[model samples]
Target: MQPQFQSMQTTGSIAVGQNRVLRNTYLMLAVSMVPTLIGALVGIQMRFSFFAGSPLVSFLVFMGVAWGFMWGIEKNKNSGLGVALLLGFTFFMGLMLSRVLQVALGFSNGGSIIAMAAGGTAATFFVLSSIAATTKRDFSGMSSFLTVGAIVLLLAIVANIFLQIPGLYLAISAGIALLSAAWMLYDIQNIVRGGETNYVSASLSVYLNLYNLFVSLINLLMALTGQRE
Candidate 1:
């Protein structure tokens, strides 16, 4: 009876810690968005073009920088530096985003389309996060499948850069949207299930999921509903 009581107390304490981690992750995620918006606005204002030269070279450089940031964040996941790195990475991502936003804003009804995409992404995040928090089903099995899908998608993207196939572009956009949603669900659930204890790392994962989801949704909406001048 005494050992059973101790086990129950241990379980409760673990639950409390997990809840704290989840709450902190949400807080950090919200804070990170400010820098992202600022970066995007600044890039748009300056007419920044990462791909001003060769697209392939630009892409390789971007990947190298992005991966370096992610590595830094992971390495410092237990410290304040991790949060800072995550925010910085998001800002870089936002700068990358300006290219798409510039293209999106080119359409006559671009503002409305952008709003719709944002709304859709928000709704999707709400739904997925709610399910992740409330559902008892295990999402652990999704990691491997999502990883494989992402690799295939990455290869497709590189191929399309040279192939320049419109249909494949649309397909990739759709794939990204779907994959991001699934990854978000899996990540949130990992936190909820106590598999992810570091708020910084968890926030970085979730932030990327949201960022990609928003970008992919914007691309899909533009391709499907954009009105040109």
Candidate 2:
């Protein structure tokens, strides 16, 4: 992920341009969400999934498709193709989320848990983003820490596919939520300070962070507040 971020071309000394890019990126991010929600809603009704009973298979499939789309987007960010690919990727992610959404909606308090998680995610984003824009202190330093944290969280999640431990899942979820929050801050701060100039790439990075945070929070809330009937 860190390498992917660094791979973007940087324009020098244009805070105004960066700000415009950031603003447009956010607008695109907001607009990009529509397809995602639609996809998730349809997925819930259709119960669509790429795999079952094989986490490894599912993981590999998802990675392959997602990375392929990401590569294409990066290659074509200067064209309309990037926006199309980004939205397409979001829809794919939304479809992927249905499995968790299905399990979550099964709990008696599922809807409440989902709402709370959404609220929490929104609040976290607002607060972190505000600090990122206002503070003169650099959060670029957090990149390394957040990257390391994310790698560990990813490894733990992969390990759990075999271990199948509840405790491990909880820990990974918590770590991911934290890392996602950190990532959001880092990405947003970079945007504000002009470290990130490509609106398409910026939107993609922040969108992924938001998606991870939302999923992690939803999982945590379901475990803690869900009431099985």
Candidate 3:
């Protein structure tokens, strides 16, 4: 009887810890948005376009900086520096996203497409996050599969810099949106199941998933709705 009681207690304690982690992750996720907004506004105002002459050059530069920022954030995850780094990374991402915004704003229905995409993304996030928070089923098994899919997709995207295939670019954008949505579910579940104990890392993972999803959705909308002046 004592052993049974102890096991139950341990399980309860773990559940509580996971709830706390999820709560903190959520709070930090909300806080990180300010920086993103600031970055977007600044970049747009500055007419920031990365390596306009070479998409490949821009892609490499962006990826290098993004990964470097993520590394720094992880290494400092336990300190105040982690918070700063995470905000910095989000700001950089927002700046990167501004190019898409710039192009989208050029379209007649650009504003409409952007609004639809944002609303759709919010709806998707809400549904997936709710499932992660309330569902009892474990989803960790999908992590390996999702990781492989993401890597393959990334390579394809990188290759497209030179290939410049419109069809392939559309496929990759659609794939990324789907994968990142799935990843958001997985990451949220990891927090719910106690697989992710650090809010810093957890927030970073979710932030990236959301950011990627946003970018992919924007790309899809642009492809569908963009018209020149």
Segments of candidate 3 deviating more than 4 angstroms: 1-8, 227-229
- Kindly give the stretch of ten consecutive residues in candidate 2 with the minimal lDDT sum: 4-13
lDDT of 1 by residue, 23-138 (tens): 99999989999989988998899898899998899989999999999999999998888888898998998899888899999999888888988899889989999999999899
Shift of residue 226 alpha carbon in model 3, Å: 3.0
Q: Rank the candidate models, highest lDDT first.
A: 1, 3, 2
The reply for model 1, stretches above 4 Å from the true place, is none
Which pairs, if any, clash in model 2? none
**Measured by TM-score, how close is model 2 to the native structure?**
0.92
In order, the Cα lDDT scores of the candidates are 0.93, 0.87, 0.90
Q: Which residue runs does candidate 2 get wrong by more than 4 Å? A: 1-13
| Candidate with the greatest TM-score versus the true structure | 1
Which candidate number would show the highest lDDT if scored against the true structure?
Answer: 1
What is the alpha-carbon RMSD of candidate 2 to the true structure? 6.8
Quote each prediction's TM-score. Answer: 0.98, 0.92, 0.94
Count residue pairs with overlapping backbones in model 1: 0
The number of clashing residue pairs in model 3 is 0
Residue 140 of model 2, lDDT score: 91
lDDT for each residue of candidate 3 in 1-229, tens digit (9 for 90 to 100): 9999999999999988988999999899999988888888888899998868788887888889999999999999999999999999999988988888888889988888778888888888899999988898888999899999999998998888889999999999999999999999999998887888999999999999888888889899989877766
